[model samples]
Target: MALFNKMLASIGIGTAKVDTRLDSDRYLPGQTVQGKVEIRGGSVEQKIEEIYLTLHTTYIKEQDDKKYTQTAALEKLRLNDPFTIAPGELRTMPFSLVLPNDTPLTYGRTKVWISTGLEIKNAVDPSDEDFIQILPGPIVHAALLALTDLGFKLRQAECEAVSYKLNHHRPFIQEFEFIPVTGPYHGKLDELEISFLSVSEERAEILLEVDRKAKGLAGLFAEAMEMDETMVRAFITKQDIPQMREKLNQIISRYI
Candidate 1:
């Protein structure tokens, strides 16, 4: 019986399993997530090399005109040194992870999760995955509200590939698409897309891509020449929210 039990444990049939339990399901950027990882031993004694946590999220990637969802690790944490878990033993390790300021929120099909794993020699590793919701920081919320106040209705929002110049850890960004159906530029513009290039407590860089509607012969000629789309960069601060509408309107006026 002893020989059979050791054999089973070696193959992970009776090894330790890891599970992380978070206090909450929703977290804001720059906030701390408190949790505990519970390690439960199976039918026999097993040696756990270490315990680690990884923050992962899914984003869209394009290859050969085909879009695919890919998982990326945003952060990693190793909790402890090697330890032995006796048969049917239960152990708990408490932990906390600091959410990054640039972390993208959970919106428009985006998913964020944490994976906890047990590292054991000569055995199949055991892991647990739990999804969490990310909330937008102050700057992003303010910008969205300002656009709504400007008569722009959100049409679509998605996470898509972005440029390296944006200084982002992820290869993609969350783009908010809007259209002015009743605003000052209703008939003049087709749509507007906004992306947060970089954001901080004191400053943020936003990208605005505007598509204009073609009207008469002159407008059609400009459209045919591929001049109906314009991209503008805006450097703004929280204090600028009161005037952000006017600032964006001025930029649209030039294209309209």
Candidate 2:
């Protein structure tokens, strides 16, 4: 009976299971995420080599005219060391993960989650996934609010794959898409896309892609040729929040 139990455990029939519970389901970028991992032993005893938590999100990638959603790991945390668990044992370990300052906000199709797993040799690893909401930091939040106040409405937000030359740490960047529905540039521009190049407590570096509205035959031709769009970079600081509207207006007016 003991040999049979060991065989079952080897095939994961009596392996350990992992579950993670977060203190909160929502967080801001750069915030410290606190949580605890729960481990429940299965029908038999098992050895856990390590416990790891990985932060993951999905991005859209285009290959040969086909679009694919790929999962990317932004960060990984290795928890407890090797330990042994007897039959039907229960263990809880507390952990904390500091979210990256550039973590994308949970908007539109963008989603973030934490995956907890146990490393067991010669056995199926038990894992769990928990979704979480990532809110924009203060600087990014101010920028979005400023755009809204300027009469722009958010249309969509997504993460798209980029060249390694552009971003080395991650293969994709999150973009916030907005349309000038009733603003001063309503008739002059079709849409505006914003991407955070980097952000910090004091300032945020952003990339703006402004798509000009096509006008007559010439405009239509230019649009078809993909020449109606212009990309510009801007830096916004906490001090600029009060004047963000005017500042953005000035920058966009030049292109329009």
Clashing pairs in 1: none
Which runs of model 2 end up more than 4 angstroms from their true locations?
164-168
How much lDDT does candidate 1 score?
Answer: 0.84
Best by lDDT: 2
Q: Rate the local accuracy (lDDT) of all candidates.
A: 0.84, 0.90
How good is model 1 by TM-score? Answer: 0.89
lDDT of 2 by residue, 169-198 (tens): 678999999998887989889999999988
- Top candidate by TM-score: 2
CA shift of 201, model 1, Å: 1.7
Displacement of residue 227 (Cα, Å) in model 2 is 0.9
